[model samples]
Target: MEAGEDIRWLPRHTVPDDLVFPFGGKDWWLIDDRLLAMGHTEAGRVTGHEIIDAPKGSHEAVALRNALWPLAIPHGEYRP
Candidate 1:
């Protein structure tokens, strides 16, 4: 965080527990407004990933991430 001027690092621990994730609870990355990269994990271990074309901008993922952004702690402020 010391040098993260242009990037916002929102760590997961500070987010509230009320976020309802889409994509079957799989971890996801909204890679711009065109692609969504989803990771398939089992027992906290990675299995594989799926890259889906999202022409409509991955509305669900975008919403969830936006919702999480404000709720999460900035990387510089997180103690753990």
Candidate 2:
């Protein structure tokens, strides 16, 4: 997904055991085949957008956020 794109992860209590793809600059939601909330992330503030559901107790819930943390800001900010 490009910068400033909003997204929602399906399934409020379970983690989807697979890779997710939130492509394009358009906002999208990542839902499992059963249409449940997992996790979500956006480039900017999600005004008026509510993160309905997410993994209740799994580390994978932060997978996308952890991965995207590097891209949150510009280079040299987190450099050693």
Provide backbone clash counts, one per model.
0, 7
* Cα lDDT tens digits for candidate 1, 1-80: 36544224555555557755577777777766458988998899999998988655488767776776766556556665
Error of 1 at 55 (Å): 3.6
Whole-model lDDT for model 1 versus the true structure? 0.68
Give residue 47's lDDT in candidate 1 (0 to 100): 96
In order, the Cα lDDT scores of the candidates are 0.68, 0.40
Per-residue lDDT of 1-80 in model 2, one digit per residue for the tens?
Answer: 36644443433233344645343223433344223332334566554433434444223435555565444444333332
Please report, as a residue range, the 10-residue window in candidate 1 with the lowest summed lDDT.
Answer: 1-10
User: What's the C-alpha lDDT at position 27 in model 1?
Assistant: 70
What TM-score would each prediction reach against the true structure? 0.64, 0.25
- Alpha-carbon runs more than 4 Å astray in model 2: 1-48, 56-61, 74-80
